[model samples]
Target: MAMTAAPPRVVATEAALALIARLLARHGPLMFHQSGGCCDGSSPMCYARGELLLGEQDVYLGDIGGQPFHIGAAQYEYWKHTQIIIDAVPGRGGMFSLEGPEGMRFHSRSRLFDDAEWAALVAQQPACFQADQKL
Candidate 1:
């Protein structure tokens, strides 16, 4: 039997994709970091590649629209069981995010992973979650 690919931990909606395309055309390359609350209120902040410094505390969730997406390690511990859905919403984005001037923000929505998806993800990256022992 052929092995199926695991579902992505992060994904973007069509509007978010279109916005990312626009940002890419103007900015060259982009990246996303899901804010861990506080001033940013958990919004997904978009930046030009290399704009923000990522340290060991950041976990690379996956890519959306070819841009890498990451979340803080502590936040990931809470969010690991859910699929992160990136959406474009009408609003001023995080003060530091590129989308602020565009009148749209990258928002995060999520749904808990069903048992099958959770199993596949665990099987695919057993080492990554070993510390949590979520299995």
Candidate 2:
């Protein structure tokens, strides 16, 4: 039997996509980094592409609304078993995020992958799963 591809590790809700489109129109290309810090740092921060300096410990999870999404490697270790869903809500966004002034904030929701999904993900990206094994 042919093996199907694993599902994406990240996705955006329609509300989040709408906000992203608006941000893109004003800021050009964009990117997202899930903060591992306290308070606002736990939220997803959106920035103009290349605005944030990525370190060696950042892991690229996937894309949402055509923008790349990433998280700290340490954070990724704690979240590798779940799928990240980006949603937009009424609130002040992360202080550094572009959406703060727009009266909406980006939020992260997650669900754990099932056994088959986890197996497929591991089969599809052995290297990534292998690194998690070391944690």
Each candidate's root-mean-square deviation in Å? Answer: 1.9, 2.2
Give the lDDT of residue 88 in candidate 2: 99
Candidate 2 clashes: the total is 0
Query: Against the correct fold, how does model 1 do in TM-score?
Result: 0.92
Could you tell me which 10 consecutive residues in candidate 1 have the lowest summed lDDT? 126-135
Clashes of each: 0, 0
Candidate 2 wrong stretches, greater than 4 Å:
1-4, 127-135
Residue by residue across 6-102, what tens digits does model 1's lDDT show? 7999999999999999999999889999999888898999999999999999999999999999999999988999999999999999998999999
What's the lDDT for candidate 2? 0.91
Estimate candidate 2's RMSD in Å. 2.2
How much is 101 displaced in model 1, in angstroms?
Answer: 0.7
Q: Model 2, 38-134: lDDT tens per residue?
A: 8686899999999999999999999999999999998998889899999999999988899999999999999998777776788877585555532
